[model samples]
Target: MAGSLGPGSGWTAAVRRLLRQFSSAQRPGSPGFQGLPLLVEGQQVGLVVPAVARELRAFPNVFVEVTGGLELRGGHCPEERTEAVAGVLAQLRAEGRLARLARWRDEAYEVRPSFGAPALLNVERAAAPLLGVLQFGAHLNAFVCRQDDETGSWQIFMWLARRSPHKATYPGLLDNLAAGGISAGLGVKETMVKESWEEARVPPKLAAQAQPVGCLSFTYEEMDGEEFGAVVRECLFIFDLEVPEDFTPQVGDGEAQEFYLWPLNKVREAVNSGSFKPNCALVVVDFLFRHGLLHPDHEPLYPELMAVMHQTL
Candidate 1:
């Protein structure tokens, strides 16, 4: 697989240019800033630092960027309900003690029942479902891969599990062209195709040609646990696949969100100290460190976490 990738085989500058504009601007929530919640439809939550709130009072929720844009931030992603969100936020600020913008991050939550039913609560104090069936988990681990005379970055494709969409993530499959190589660099075997066609509208060719990598996780809790106080084992999976460096996700995947790669240093630091998606710190960071992604300079920064992974994983 490494040999097939020759000179000038990677992400285009256009892709880098697009990701930089946003990745550069948005750091995770500041540790010093307290999160204030703005009420949403039925009290759903979003976060804003005080400085962010003050700045927000001035502009609309979305905007255009110097490069890749159509920005929806400060309590809004384009996928979110726009006017409803704005109204709820306005009302929350007016009624409740101005919340420190609660964010609906995919991690860090409490499980308990108030009215005798299981529910998941984020730090923002909003509720969502639990006890669900998900297809699988996918992994994205960035690495600094280099060839002589050409030192560059590569997010290596790792692995994936089989299930189905009509049933689970990938239904009865293994040894596809996408992942077999990295794990053992063999080649295509009996494998499944991409769900892009089923979910978003990406071309089948794209999915077929697209390699599956590490885990893209789907995790949830059972509401019964909150009411019954039962212990559920934490669940997770690791998917490994590959994609063209310049590939842009089609709208088929339920994920309307965007991803931009940052410098390895910046991503490592933010994932360590900042309030990023909790799973990242929980899973990705440990994997990267165990795999030698962090620099010597960074190891000292998160010595305890580093040490833990070094010992555990």
Candidate 2:
């Protein structure tokens, strides 16, 4: 029987009693089933439970409920099941394993479901609004990689992307690499690399190592007040490109600026002087410096870059 730790609430107690009833219904010698985790789509909720195949399938968030039970992995259960399972979840939530306990809000969308296509589009449009203005839309990144002669560090060239000059990126809500403003959005390393390839015609083989090292969010609300420059807003999703030393950047159309391995300090100076957009620059540079690839003596390449970084907040 699916019993829980400590006593349960009203809903939980009811379900526990029902489980006790159901367990009694099962044949005693029947082979035991393991529990599995459940993942709810509409909301970021999950729960784990052990039961026969059919019992867990009734869950709303379950995409592919296994035949045999799993080790109660994640997500919430059906409202019908919630009343019964809440006790187990409540106990787990208190222990910090299941913090985002929630009820299913929208079932219709759940019925059909989205493959997170919106997140992909939001990221592309957010990075480069007029990206579609061209025959092809590409969110560009210039990765500069070098093989250290002494240390033999063979890694990424430049994991930085140019600050998009396109004024108004459509999906204005995506503040960083994650929490996007659209109804749904993309949030992972490989996805960003694909976006770069799609937008810039970067050959797939070249972009193979595009990894998501980190995310830096730059928000512009300066347009909230009067007029003129105060009316522009944008969000840039930062991505890291790690490629072999021989890999050269492939630029499509009029997308990338001077493509080369500029010293980190020089890139920093450009950012500080406002010669470069601070969103990708600050985020990428800070990440590179933190990795020890940067020599400690490297000074502030762009002092004003700090201002740009701060102003975004």
lDDT of 2 by residue, 173-220 (tens): 111121112222233444455555543455666555555443333322
Tens digits of lDDT, candidate 1, 205-238? 6555443333322222222222311111222233
Q: What is the C-alpha lDDT of each candidate?
A: 0.31, 0.33
Query: How high is each candidate's TM-score?
Result: 0.32, 0.38
Clashes of each: 42, 35
Model 2: per-residue Cα lDDT at residue 45: 23
Task: Output the number of the TM-score-best candidate.
Answer: 2
Regions of candidate 2 where Cα sits further than 4 Å from its true position: 1-191, 228-237, 293-313
TM-score of 2: 0.38
Per-residue lDDT value at 45 in model 1? 29
Cα displacement (angstroms), candidate 2, residue 282, comes to 1.8
